[model samples]
Target: MKVRLGFVANSLSLWDASPAKTITYKRYTELPKEERMDRLQEVTRLNLEHTKRILYLCAAHEIELYRLSSSLVPLATHPEVEWDFHTPFKKEWRELGDLIKKFGIRASFHPNQFTLFTSPRQHVTDNAVKDMVYHYRMLEYMGIEDHSVINIHIGGSYGDKEETLGRFHENLKVLPTHVKEIMTLENDDKTYTVEETLAVCQKENIPMVLDIHHHEANLSERPLEDYLEAIFATWEKRDLVPKIHISSPKSEKAFRSHADLVDAGFVEGFFKTLKTFDQDVDFMIEAKHKDLAMLKLIEDLSTIRGVKRISGGALEW
Candidate 1:
C-alpha cells in the first residue's frame, strides 16, 4: 500500500462563528437532536459540495485527498421527524449509503468516543456495540467497508491498566466482525500512547494508529526517544505495526489554544523520524484544518523526499 496522509474532518468543517474559536463536544451534545440533525443536514449538503471543490483545489496543487470516516455519521443518521429504537435513524439507511457512495472519496469513521465496551453500566456497552455494528453495516450498505475501515478510540483507560487491557481483550472476543481489515485503533490524548497501545495490539492482534499530537500531550514530556522506543518495542511482537496518526507536539498552553502541529515543519520532522525506521506505515494528518493541513504537510514531505505528484486539481475529483 502506498503511504497516505489524511485529515480528521470534524475539527475542520464544523467551526463556530464565535470568538472562542474552539469546537466543544458538550455544545454538540447539548443541541436538541432535531436541531442537530437539521444542522448536520445542511453541513452535509455544503460539505459534499465542498468536497468536490476541494478535489479541484487539491488536484490543482498536486495534493492527494484522504477522507476520514467518522465525520460522516451524522449524515449517515436518517433525518426523519422522529427517531426511536425501532428506527435508529429517521431516514432510510440506504439513503445514507447513497450519499456516501456519491461522494466517491476515501473516508472512514473513528470508533465511538462515548463507547465503552467495559463499562459497568449494564446497557452502555451493549448500545455502543450496537451503534458500532450499525456503522460497519452502514459502511457495507454504502459499499465502503470493503475498502475502508473506520478509526476508533480505544475506550476509556478505566484507572487500572492491567484490568483495562484484560477487559478489552475479553470484550473484543465476543464482538461481531463484519468489516474489512481497515478498522484501526488510535492512541488518544487522554489515555494510552502508541507504545501502550502497541502492547494491547500485540495481545489483540489489531492495527495501530499513532496520534503524534496525543503523544506530545501525554507521553513526550519524558525523553521523546524513549517514547519512540516504546513505539518500536512492540512492532515485531504485534501482528500490525501502527505508523498512522500524524501531528506535532501538542501544547497544554491553555484550556484552549494549541500550537499547530499540522504545519509543514512538523510534517518534515515526522518524515525525518520515520526515515530511521525500517518498515512501511500509513499516516493521517490530524491538524486543526484536516484536509487543508494535510495538503501542506504532504506537499512539504514529498518535496523533502525529492518526489512530485499533484492532486486531481481543483476541477478534477
Candidate 2:
C-alpha cells in the first residue's frame, strides 16, 4: 500500500502564510464605502500571495495533496457584496493552477459547515448553492475545476435523519450538474456515520471522502472495515484514488477534537486494515499543527517495519 499525505490549509512551518484571512461582513460594512472594495482587494491579494508561497513550499517538499482555504476570497458569497474576485487575480489564479499541475498536487476545497443541502429552510439551501458555486468558481478560475473536487459534509439531521436526507436530495437539485459532478461528501464527527455517508454517495453517484477521526468518534454498528471496500469503490467511477482524512483525538477527554500532531499508534490499526486492500490512497491530515503534523506522521509511519519513505510526504509499505 502506498499513501500520499497532506495537510489542511495554512502551514505552521511558514510564518504569516495563512490563505484564509478574511473580513467579516460587519467589518466590511463598517469600512467607508470607498475603502470597502480596497480592503477586500488588499486582503484577497495577501491571501492569494500567501497561498502561492505555500504552494511553492509544497512543491519543494513533494507534498502532492492540499485543501485550498475556502476563505481565499473575503465575502465571496455574501448576499450584499458584489465584487469580481477573478478578474483582478486572473494571473494569480492561473499561476496557482500551473504550480499545482506542475507538482501533481491533488487540490481540493472543503466549504465551511454552513454549506449544506440538508437544511429545511429555503434560504439556507439557497446559500448552500451559492457557497458551492463560489468554491466551484475558484476552481474554475484556476482552470482545475475538471479534476479538483469540492468536499462537504452530509449536514445536520435537523431532528430527523430520513426526512433531512430526503430534503438533502431535493435541495441538492438546485446545484449545477457540473458543480455537483465534482462534489464529494464526507462523514461528519457527530451526525453521519461512514455507512450512512457511503450509502448516500452510492445513491447519488458521488465520491466519498472518509474521515477516520469522525468514524472513530461516531462509529457505525459494523466495523469500518465492513464498509471500507464500498467506500473506496465509490471513487472508481471518478478515476481518482480515494481520499481520507486522518487525525488523532486531542485527548481522551476531548475525543472529538483534533490533536496538535498525529499519533501513529492511534491509527496503526487503520493502516493495517487498509493494507489488506493494497490500494493507494491520499490522506489529508486534519491535526492542529497543519503541515508539521503531516510531516511528523509520515516520519512516524516510516519507522515501522516494511514501510518505505517514498518522498517527503509519501510512504509505501
Candidate 3:
C-alpha cells in the first residue's frame, strides 16, 4: 500500500506567494473604468505566477497531490464582473498544466462553501452552476480538464434532509455532464456524514472524498470501517487514486476547526483502518500550517511499524 500527502493553497514557506489574491468587488467598483479590467488582470497574473512558484516547490519536494486555489481569477464568477480570464493568460495556464503533468502531480480544485447545489432559490442554483463553470474553465484553459477533479460537500440539509437531497439531485442537473464527471462530494463536518455523502456519491456515480476529521467530529450511526470498502469503490471509475482530507481539531471546544498541524495520535486509528484495505490513497492535508503540516505528518506517519518513507511526501507500507 502507498499513501501520498500534500497541502492546500498558500504555503507558508513562500513569502507573498498566495494564489488567492483578489480585488474585492467594492474595490473594483471604486476604480476608474480604464483600470478595472487592468486591475483584475494584474491580480490574476500575480496569482498565476505564484501558482507556478508553488508548483515548482511541490515538484522540488516530490509532492504528488495539490488543491489549486479557486480564487485564481478575481471576480471570476461574479454575476456582473465575469470577464475573459482565459485569453490573455494562455501561456501561464499552460505552464501550470505542464508542470503538473511533468511532475505526475494530481491537481484539484475545491470551490468555496457557497458554491453548492442544495440551495432553495433558483438564483442560488444559477450561481452554483456559474461557480462550477468558473472552476471548469480554469482546468480547461490549463489543458488538464480531464485529469483533475473539483470537489464539494453535499451541502446543507436545510430543515429537511430528504427534501434537500432531492433538491440537490434536481439542481445538480444544471451542471454540464463533462464537468460533473470530474466532480467529487466530500463529507462535511457539520451536516453530511460519511454514510450520507457516500450514498450521494454512489447515486451520482461520483467519487467520495472522505474527510477523516469531519467523520470524527460528526459521528454516523454506522462504523467507519463498514463504509471503507464502499468509499474506496466510489473512485473505481476515475483514473486517480482515492483522495482523503486529513486534519486535526483545534480544541475540544472548537472540535470542527482545523489545527495548525495534524496530530498523529488523532489520526492513528483512521490510518490503521485504511491500512486494512490494501489500496493506494492520496491525503490532502487541511491543516492551518499548510506545507509544514504535511512534512510533519509525513515524518510522523513514517514512524509506524509497517510504513516506510518512500519520498518527501509519499509513504509505502
TM-score, one value per model: 0.66, 0.98, 0.99
lDDT of each: 0.53, 0.93, 0.93
True-structure RMSD, every candidate: 7.0, 0.8, 0.7
What is the C-alpha lDDT profile of model 2 across 249-311, one tens digit per residue?
Answer: 999999999999999999989998899999899999999999999999999989988899999
How far is 187's C-alpha from truth in model 1 (Å)? 1.4
For residues 188-233, what per-residue lDDT tens digits would candidate 3 score against the true structure? 9889999999989999999999999999989889999999899999
Worst 10 residues of 1 by lDDT: 15-24
lDDT of 1 by residue, 137-246 (tens): 65665555765656666677678877877777667665676542455666777777666776676566555667766766667345444455555544443344344677
Weakest lDDT window of 10 consecutive positions for candidate 2: 74-83
lDDT of 2: 0.93
Residue 116 Cα positional deviation in candidate 2, in Å, after optimal superposition: 0.7
Q: Count the clashes in each prediction.
A: 20, 0, 0
In the predicted model 3, the residue pairs found to clash are: none
Q: Quickly count the clashes in candidate 3.
A: 0
Candidate 2 residue spans exceeding 4 A from truth:
none
Better of 1 and 3 by TM-score: 3
